[model samples]
Every structure is written in structure tokens, then in C-alpha cells.
Target: MMTEPAQNTIIEQHINLDDVADLNDTNPLELLVQATGLSKQRVKDAMTKGAVWLSHGKQARPLRRKNARLRLGEELHLYYNEQVLSETVAKPELIADEGDYSVWNKPNGVWSQGSKWGDHCSISRLVEEHFDYNRQTYVVHRLDKAARGLLILAHNKEAAAALSAMFAKRTVEKHYLAWVNGQFPHDSITIDKPIDNKPAKSIVTLKEYDADKDRSLLSVQILTGRKHQIRIHLSSLGFPIIGDRLHGEPTQSQDLQLMAYKLDFQCPITGDKKAYQLKTWT
Candidate 1:
């Protein structure tokens, strides 16, 4: 039988010039900054700290200058102490579809959209990449990056306008599931809070309980769309969602345990009930 190699073994080798020549085409500082998304000063500081390594198998010392110049086949090892930007988009399965609108099951840790540079992975980019370019796409609403569950997308301008109006008008029904920190006192409670001049209402129903963990699972229905409405409302009730950084009981976990589990809306064009439910639960 063959034995597997040790995990910590470091394998180093000498390669031909053509392999790393493209790295020399750009300045080292520029390449490092682009690769690590660090400022020039930070890169220089790393160099001073012996964090940068050259092809000659030499660690960059303080006396060593910070230059971008390199010969062909020179190996560059950069030690970055930051999270690397994700380039791939999270593609959720399409649940429901209309002429110009569709619903998807968005998983946790995926952004709904990103900034102009497209430096970060996002759901919008994923949809755009999968759909026809002639059609315009827009997010009718947003879910927190850490929150999972159902999300609605509009394929064209008309669909976007209609769905946006539905959200603004409070015609769409949104339901969520949250694993909260403490036991809820009441069986059901309605929260009416003003969010950004819009009246937001949520009906929370306790579903399950874990006595050992002192936690309760809740089914939350939102009558209005507001940024962090469910999370904020639950937090205000003193039973913040477990693992929620913004509102949860502070410990070590920073991820929110809330999920947008279900969405029900009337299709603007088809006039049919558009309901989407998430099959996966974490």
C-alpha cells in the first residue's frame, strides 16, 4: 500500500524563466498591491518585516530595498495577512420563474450585489452571468451577507419597477427563520416599528426550543421590507439571533443565524401567486 505524504512537507523546486516572466511585466509593488489589496505603505511595512521573499530564496530584510524589478523566472512569495477577495459568484438554484422575475435560494455568506469594481463575489453578478444580457436585472430587496434563504430577482426594467413597488407598498409577504439566544416568553408577538419612515411589522412565532442551549427557534413573518428589520426587531426583544454579530449575544461567533426562508408575492405580469421556500437549513 502507498502511504500519503506528510501534510506540512514543503516542496520547493527550480522552474524555467517563461513560467514567472509575466509577473515581471508589472512592477512588484503594483502586483503585490493588486494581489493582496494592501496599500503601498503596508506593502513596504511587510517588506521591512521580512514578510516578502524573492526568487533567490532570500527573505526581504530591512536593509533590502523595496523594488518591483525582477528577472524572468524569479519566484516571488508574498505573505498577506488579510482575507483574499473572492472572484467567483454564488449561484443559487432557481426556484420560481416568471416572464421577467425569478426567485432563488440564496445561501449564507454571499452578497446580493457588490460595488462597481466587481472585486467581490455577489449574487447579482451571478444572475447576470447566467441570464441573457439584453435583459436588465435588479434585486427587489436585499438580505444580509450572512443571512440565507429566498431572494427575488427582476429580469427587466418593468419587472424591477413592479416588484420594487410591491415591496414599497408592503404587498409582498416575507417569512424568516431564526435561531435566537434566549427562550421567548410569549407564543407569538407582533412587532410594529418604524424603519426609514416605513412602518415595518413582524409576527414572530416560537417554533422549537433547546433547553440546554437556552435558545429558541422562531418563524418570523414580515409585513414590510426594511433593512435588518427582523434582526433589529428580534434584538430589541432581547432575543437576538444566535451567531448574529450585529444583534446577537456577544461571544465568539460573528455570523447571523437568521435566514429568509420563504417569500410570497403576486407576479405583476402573470397575476399568479409566486411562492418560494428554501429546502436547506443550517
Candidate 2:
């Protein structure tokens, strides 16, 4: 029987070349192939997945193309991680396209940020691809990769700044829905806990209870956005959301049960009230 490779087992290396003859080579693919002694298809696949890089002096960026000419004296780097690059990215649903800014239903496991290996699975990168890369993409806020639901991506700088300011000023109303492991109190409760020495608040209201599963469906509105505020607050109360491996107990559902179900706020660019919610919930 064959065995699957562990996720931690990976090849990560930076190849540097300075010889005069090696520097004169213009083809990045040929240079990487000869230098690393890897197959052409493997090298090409690495480049396309953003595992290749070009660096000079202090500046460095990903090099994501094959058959591209390389500049003399510039350094070539390859970060080959078969585990990271091979994982599939979940698809996000575009809820509304407001031109300057758009709303999306980000699925669980979809990242809000990109990594050195690549951002092919990130919502920010996905939004850029949605517009065919004509408009610049800006990230105003983020949702946890394990939690799914509503997110906004600003298409331009002005919109990005304005929307970010709204979050900073706490004008954006963010609501979350979670299925927790235990039964919660019938009365709504407000948790005013200090997270990381900063004041954070979350108001949780019970919507339904499953007698069979002994779990509760909760509606959580966070007044202060801290890192994992909702998850931390609920877990602190001993009603950890199901599948929250980081702070809560493991459950049957492998995916995180928490979700940013709704976003309500005044549109900064249009001065219109905007409310977006997911059509379906689990």
C-alpha cells in the first residue's frame, strides 16, 4: 500500500546565482531547470503557481510566468511546497457588484490574505480575477479562513480608504451566526471582555435550540472587532462553536461552525444604506 506524504514535509529553498555566465542567461525556465535539475513541466508548474520569484538588492516579488526573460544580475528564488500548492481553493459567490466596492459570500477555507507560496485561493485574488484584472483590488477588512460568509472588496483605492475608515470608526454593523456545541441561555447576553488588553464587546442572542444535538444556534453582533472576537467570546462562555479546533472542542463537522452571516452599513461612496445577508445558512 502507498502512503500519503505528511503536510509538513516540503521543499523550500532559495537558489542564488552570481556567476557571470549564469547571470547572462535570459530564460528563467531554462535557468531554473538547469540549476535545480527538475523536469521542465515541474519547473513550469511551479512558476505558474507563484512559487518562483525574482529579487534584486532588497526588493523581492513573486515571478509567476514561464518563458519570461530574466534580467542579468537578478536573483531567482523557488519555493516548492507540494502540499500548499496542491490544495483546492473553494469558490466564492459574488453577491453584489457596486463597481467601486463589491460584496461576496466567502466560503470557509477561502483565505482573505495571500501567502508567499501563492494566493490562488484567496478572496482578494479571486475578486481581481473576477474583474479580469482591469481594476485594482483592495482589502478593507478580513474574515477568518475557517469561518465563512459576507465580505467586501474595494475595487479602487478611494473606496478602499473610505470603507476601511468605516470599519475603523466602527460604523459598519457586522453580524455573525454560529452553531455552538452547548445550549446557551435563553436571555440575550452581552460579553464585554478585554481581548489582548483591548476592550471588546459582543452581543449574543439565541435563535434556536436543537434538543437532539444539544446545540444552540446563536446570532452574534460584535460591537468591537478583535481578532477572533466572536469565537473567543463564545468559547469563554463554555459554548464553543462546533468545529472550532483552535479554541473549542472537535466535532463531527470538520468545518468551523461560525459565519459572518450579515453586514449592514451606510455606503460611503453613494450615501445609501446597504444591507447584505447570505441567502442560505447551514
Best by TM-score: 2
lDDT of 2 by residue, 91-148 (tens): 8888999999989999998989877786777888788887887877788999999999
Candidate whose lDDT is highest: 2
Report, for all candidates in order, the number of backbone clashes.
Answer: 2, 0
The parts of candidate 1 lying over 4 Å away from their true place are: 1-84, 87-90, 132-135, 195-198, 280-282
Summing lDDT over every window of 10 consecutive residues in candidate 2, give the lowest-scoring window.
1-10
lDDT of 1 by residue, 1-282 (tens): 323224332222223334544754665665566555556775565454334556654533111246656666455555533232223445676777675877877777778875322213567656665674455568888888888888888988888988888887878788899988778887999999887788888999998888998889899998877888998898888888888776665564656788888878787777888777776565
User: How close is every model to the real structure, measured as TM-score?
Assistant: 0.65, 0.89
**Deviation (Å) of 251 in candidate 1:** 4.1
> Which pairs clash (backbone N, Cα, C closer than 3 Å) in model 1?
28-68, 243-255
